[model samples]
Structure formats: C-alpha cells, structure tokens
Target chain A: MASEVKFEKVDFYYGAFKAIDSLQLTILARKVSAFIGPSGCGKSTVLRMVNRTNELVAERTRLEGRVLIADENIYDGVDLFSLRKKVGMVFQRPNPFPKTVYENIAWAPRIHGVKRTDELDEIVEKSLKRAALWDQVKNKLKSSALSLSGGQQQRLCIARSIAVNPEVLLMDEPTSALDPRATARIEDLVEELKADYTIVIVTHSMQQAARISDSTAFFLSEGAGRPGRLIEFGETERVFTNPSSRLTEKYITGRFG
Target chain B: MTRARVFDLSAKAVAWAVAISTMVFLILIIGYVVIRGVPSIASVGLEFFTTAPRGIKMQGGVYPMIVSSIYLTVLSLVIAFPIGLGAAIYLAEYAGRGRFVELIRFSADLLSGVPSIVFGLFGLAFFVYFLKMGYSVLAGALTVFLMVLPTLVRTSEQAIKAVPRSYREASLALGASKWQTIRRVVLPSAAPGILTGVILAMGRAFGETAAVLFTAGSVPQTPASPLDGGRTLTVHLFYLATQGQIEDSFRVAAVLLFVVLGFNLTAGWMMARFRRRFG
Candidate 1:
C-alpha cells in the first residue's frame, strides 16, 4: 500500500500549551486507519490535522512540522478551498443545513462548480446511492434534512461529502452519538467504503478499532499536565494481539490508558 | 388550609390581580378614545379617511397625516435595516473579544437609553436645519432611523448570537467560505428573530411623536415628494389637543390606536408561525 497521508515530527499547540507532541505516522490509501485512545489523548487532534478542521479552535493555535498528503505538504500555502473540497469531513453530530434532503445532497456539488441541472441530479443520485441512503430517502427528497432520524442524517451527511468525489473522508466519532443498530450499520458501510477512499477515523472504542480498521495507532498521555504522543502503530492484528511496546500491551489488555 | 397552601393561593391571587388591572387600564384608554371618537367620526363619515386636512379650519379629515405616517415608517426601516443588521452581524461574528468591541456595545446601549425628546432636539438641530432636509419626510425618516438604530442593533445581535455554533463549523468543513456560511446558514436561522426586532422597531417608529414633531413638520397636505413637508397622525393629534379641539383629537387618537393594534396582531401571528416551523 502507498502512503496517502504522512505526519512528520508534528507538534500541535493550543495557545501556550501543547496538545500533540512529536507525532509521526503514515496512513496508507484505500485503507481504514483507526486512532484509538482515551479522552484528551490527541487522537481527535490528529484526525483534524488532516483536513485542517482544527483551524476553527477559536484560540491562538500553532502547528510545527509537516502534514503531507500524497507527498505534498497541506499547510504550506495550499489552496484551502480546493483542498477542503478534495478531502471531505463528517462531524460527530449530523448537522445538515436547514434545507431539504435534495438541497443538502446537491449543495456541495453546486458550490464546487457543478451548474448543469441534469449533472447535479445525476451526482446527487449516485452519491446517495453510494452512501446507502437513496432507497430510504428517494421518495422524500423534498423533506427537511432535520426531519430524518439521527442515523439517517449521519448517512445523508456522508452522502453529501461523497458528492464532491473526495480522495479522503475524515470522520470524528461518527458513531458515538448513535445507538447500537445504527452503529452496526455504519460499521458495515465503512467496510464497503474502504475500497475507494482513504478512511481516517477517531474512535474511543477499542472493539470498534479492532473490528473494522486494517491498521491501528495507539496513543496515550504520559501523566498529568502532559501532551499525548503515539505509543505504537502496526497492522491491527499485531497491535492488538502482539504489541511490541509494554505500554501498548498493557493498554490493549485493559491495564490502564 | 395549611399555611403553605394558603400563602400559595394568596400569591397567585395577587399576581392575577396585578395582571388583570394592567389589562383593564389598557382597555379603558382604548374604550374611552373609541367612544369619544364615534360622534365626530359619524358626523364626518368617510370624509375622515378620504379628504386631506383643512389645516387651521380643522373641518376636513386627516388623510394626509395617515399617508405621512406610513411613508415615514417605511423610509426609516429602509434606512436602518441594512446598516443595523450589518453592524449586528459584525458584533456577533467578526468583532474581537477586546476593549474595542466592548466600547461599541456600550455605545449602542447608551444610545438606546437616550430619551426620544433628546432625539427630537438633535433632529431639530442636525436634520431639520444642518442637513437642509427642512422639516420633510426624509428628515423625519433619517432622524427616526438614528433614534431606533440601537434597538435594531441590540436585538439583531441577540438573534444572531442564538444560532448554534455547530452550524458554522459544519459549513466551513464543507469548503464554504466565511461569507457564504453567514449568508446561507447564520442569516437564514436568524431571520425570524431579526424580523421580530424589525417589527418592534416599526411599532416604535409609527407611533413616534416628539421626533416627528421636530423634524417632520405640521404641513397638512398630500405629500408628493419625500422633500415635501408632511404631518403624521401623532403630530396632528398633538396639534388638535393643544388647540383645544377635543373631538378631533379623540378621532385621531382612535385611528392611531387601531393602527398600533393591527401591527401587534400581525407581529404575534408571525412569531407564532415562525415557532411552529423552526421549533
């Protein structure tokens, strides 16, 4: 597998305090890579670093080091508009605009310069079908996106992102707000989606990382008032069953975070 | 009865009594005006609504005054809405958490608290004389726009602040620019709220007496231009009362009351509809 995203000697800080300290990792394309850790472990920080979603932290934040996507540094005066369009994101909560389902699906395409009516309709259909939501929502495309259930809204959000045909999809706790049934459905969807796009997920559930991800990176904060750093990274089977580091072994065996 | 139960009942009784008395006072004022107005209105017939005022003769009706009131209210809104809403968006979204923003907010609050009579004096000095609008509808509209601007800014800022933060984040993450996010998401979600502020400002502008008395002259004619001097209902009623024309004052007061009541009803219905759809 080729490396699609590489974080080289990255140090992320929020104001005067550091959040991510000296992290290094290479995520491969067309694979599900899970970053699993306890709360405040900077796993979510790592996930946000990819698409620069952390830019809205509303505090004085600074990043040192390179976050390269396909061997290109994403932070060095990159065209953020096109970069964001190419790398879509699904938030923890399903926040659809105060618009109809069809508008929600069509909005991304329209803004990204798709102006033809027939082309937009076709993209909306294909995107929704890929997100596994076309059948359930086809009849009610005119309904408000907010009217759907939580799970359906999340899927719609996914479809909305994929409408832009992004090269990567970033999900931040995509199932934490969902019930088990919805969670299971999303897990299945991820398994199928990994065939075409690079999927990066931030999850606190160890079982979740074990079940779906092909590669896993374990992270931990050393102690009080310390920034989190990566502890281990390898194929999922070895990371869970035969971690080389004592810290990764103890965490996987439920010793402590 | 237990002491606690007795005290609760008495408290409820006091609250109900206070509320009912306020309602009664309102009703008495409206009722007195309507009753006193009937004799003069019946004597005048449809001429009250159709004919222009006869000025000092006071024999015709107040049609010109009604037209002036409508024009003044609409013009003030046209001048104030865009500027006030823009200021509000800046305060809510772009303003820094610093002493500068604090200074702006403090100024807006202080402006709202200044008396309408003070606004009248300023209008008399600045708009009527200095700007050379010369006691015209434009002068009155510009003065009232300044007078009600603080209300629009404060209320619109509150409405914009009420939108959820998640909406902003979601829009930005979708590759939409900051302006696009605000235009599509923030403003739409804040529309009903800002509209409430607008309606409240309109009510205040429509009934304003002192500001218009100073700036919007007492000319009783059908104004053909914004530059032409005009007389609003409140000014007409004030003139009649001061001149001891009790019956004419009563009729004008009744008309003003009904117009205000109509505005309140529309505002209530609009707010209820907004709640039903967006809640």
Candidate 2:
C-alpha cells in the first residue's frame, strides 16, 4: 500500500512571501525519511504539501510546481479526500478529537464508509494494537481521548490515521512535544511501521534524525526572510559521515543552522 | 501607613463597595418583585394557569397568554435556529475575508443593536401588512425570529471560531471531508456554546412584549393555530397593568420570571453534561 512521494522543483509562497524555493526531493516507498532543520526552515511546509494540508492554514498560498504521490500529480485535479486518505498526517502536538478513544479511531473509517459495528470494532482494535496503545486503553475505549497522557494521545493520533488504511504517513515533528521515553516508543513504532507504510518525518533534533531514519534531507534558510532550500539529501549514514556540500557538513557538525 | 499602602486600601474599599452595591441592587429588585407577586399568585391558585381570561380579563386565568408565549418562543426558534446556525458556520469557516462577509457581519451587528420597538414596527409593516399574515402568532414569531437572529448568529460564530484549529487539522488529515470534519468534530465542540446562545435568545423571546405587541394582537382567547391572533404573557401583563388589573399583572410577571429561570437552569445543566461527556 506504500507509495513514493516526489516534489519536483517546487516553489511555494504564503501570499507573496516565498516559503520554499526550488525544492526537489523524492521520498521512497516503505522507508522512513527524516527532514532535519531549524525552526523556520520550511521542512514542515514541504511535508504538508504531500497532503495539501498547507492550504488550510494560509488562504492566499501559491504553488509553482507539482507534488506527486505514486506517479499521480496531487495538485492538478486530485480529490483532497482521496489524496489525504492515501497520505495521512500526524501533527506536532497530540491532537486527538474531543471524543472517546474508540470514536477517535472509528471516525475516519466511518467517514470512509465502513459502517458495520463488528468491522469498526476490528479495525479499531487492530489500529490501536498497531499504534501500541491497545493494552493501556483496551479497557477504557469508551473514555475520552483527552484523558490519556500526552504520549498516549499521540499514539492514538497515529492509530486514527492508520485506521483509514493509508499508504503514506507524514509526521510533522511528531515527537517534539513528547518526553524521552514517549519519543523512543514512537521511534520504535516508526521503525516497525516502515516495513509497511512510507513515512516522512520532520524533526528539529539531529540525533533523532540520525537514530531512526533510513534517509536524511537537510533543509536551511540561508538568511532572514529568504526561502528555505534543500541543502543535502542522501543515505543517512553517508550524509552524516561524509556530506558533499560544505554547508551540509557544517550544519551536520553543529556549526550553524 | 505608607502612601502607596493607603492608595491600595482605598482602591480595595471602593471596588468592594461597588461590587456589593451591584449585588444589593439585583437582590432588592428580585426580592421586591417576588414579594409583590407571590400574594397574587397564591390567591389565584392553579386555575390562574389553566383557565383562559374571562369577564374583561379581570377574573379568569392567563392560560391563553401562557400558551401563546410558548407557541411564539418555539415557532421563532424553529424558524431562526437553522438560518442563524448556517450563517454562523459560513461566516466562521467558509467565507473569506471579503466585502460580502464583512457586510453580512456588520448588518447582523447593526440589527442586534436596534430597539425591539423598531423590530415590532418592521414586523407590522412587513409580516403583518405586506405579507398579510394579520395580527397572529405567526407574525409575532416572525418578528421575534428576526430580532433574535443577529444575536444568535454572532454568538454561534464566536463559538465555532473558538474551537481549536488543531482539531480541524487532525480531522482533515485523517481523510474526512470538510463537511464531515465540521459535523463530527467542530460542531460538537461548539455545541455547548451554541446552546448558551440559544437559551439566551429563548429567554429574550419569552419575555418580549413590545415586539409581540404590535405583531401579535392583544386577544385574550387561546390561539388555536399559528394564524390565530393571540397575546403572549408579557403582552397580556402589559394589558392587565395598563387596564387596572394590577394583581393579575403581578401574577403574570411572577410566572414569566420563574419560566425564564427554569430555561436558564435547564440549559446550564445540559451544558455541564455536554462538557463532562466531551472533556
């Protein structure tokens, strides 16, 4: 079910203020790719483009290139529901709905036309198990999703996205707000999930990118108000050890953002 | 004491006095009304509520007026709730920051600020005269609906806007369509706040007199249909007080106070239940 996501020389603007400049990158199917950069580096923007979620935040946005998933141009004539169904997202914060844990997982499937109670139950259980939240919340499915701890809530969010049986998962700093143990658990979950789903993660921590990702794409905005550009993209091990660009090496070695 | 300390103490005394005076004024008004009305209510017994007015509306119950008030409130709500909620959702979620939306919002604000008497005049000219609905419950309800719509729309818009943006993002990313996200997540979260606005509008509709007076006639008979002319409790209260039936008017006032209080309490209880379920 996994699908590769490709950004072909994309230029994005938030109402005339350029955000991403001439960015070209391909995220392989069934692999974990990490985007590591500073706060305003547009890594999150690039990730959002894969599912067209950036349109929700800024109304006057303008895009200058194609975002393709599984060889289909998502920006041209694709249905947002189908596009988002194929490529799910987990936000930086754990944003579970103000509903029961069971409802949170069942919601997407229900919207997607899965109505039978037994089928919804099976999907909910399988999703929670996959997200590693089944054990703790198995007896409390009826409880509000907001009652869970932060990490648990994030995992529930992951469960909710996967319940729709998506192919690609876009995670925007999914673990930035989590504690070390919760972050490690998510890292472990990501490692396991990569066997089936294509995952793109944006992270601020260099160590986190080094720890779990198969490939690394480093992004940087050279100066203030300048559009962010992709500086380097390669195998994680090679990029960290022997980068081609001096700027990439400097950023990897903690010289500057 | 230091000068600063003295200043602080004086400020505290003044603030406390102002707060206490406000509380005292509220209690005094309620207490005086209840005391004045209770004797009249007690003398009338249950018949005061069950029987229609008779003998020039001096001896019989205010039953028809009570029924008319309820009918007006319910009909106005039925007519206005959907339109107001739809407008609110559009203004908050779909509409862009354009001139049309701005004009709509400004018109709503301006309408809400207009006096109820003005609304009564409009109702008389439009629904009563032009529409030819006559001085009936339908005309009164249409007037009340227009008067209440602006307030309802503004409050519901604020409530919908206040829902956390993250919830919308989460729903959209999970493959739900925009309408689906709004129905399942956004509206539910905003339900309690919207209910507050509804209840406030209900109270206003129930207690309204000036607007209903011109639209709904001062007929004492029970309205058999929305097209039948009737008088609400507030309009009936006005008729009684103006025509030297002071005791009957007091009884009507007491009933109005209690019914409005009942609506508020019920709404508060429902809001608490909704919060507990959602949170």
Question: For candidate 1, what is the lDDT?
Answer: 0.88
Model 1 docking grade: medium
How far does residue A218 in candidate 2 sit from its true spot (Å)?
0.6
Q: TM-score of every model? A: 0.93, 0.95
- Model 1 pairs in collision: none
Candidate 1 recovers a fraction of native contacts equal to: 0.52
Return the interface RMSD of the candidates, in order shown, one decimal each.
1.5, 1.0
For model 2, the docking class works out as: medium
- Highest DockQ: give the candidate number: 2
Candidate 1 lDDT by residue in tens digits, A95-154 = 887778888889878877899999988998998899999999999888888888889989
User: Per-candidate DockQ versus the true complex?
Assistant: 0.57, 0.79
Reported per model, the fraction of native interface contacts reproduced equals 0.52, 0.89
Output per-candidate TM-scores for chain A, rounded to 2 decimals. Answer: 0.96, 0.98
Q: What is the DockQ of candidate 1?
A: 0.57
> What lDDT is reached at residue B97 by model 1?
87
| Cα lDDT tens digits for candidate 2, B203-278 | 9999999999999988887899999999999998898899998877778888898899899998899999987887
Predicted structure with the largest lDDT when compared to the true one: 2
Candidate 1 chain A worst ten-residue window by lDDT: A1-10
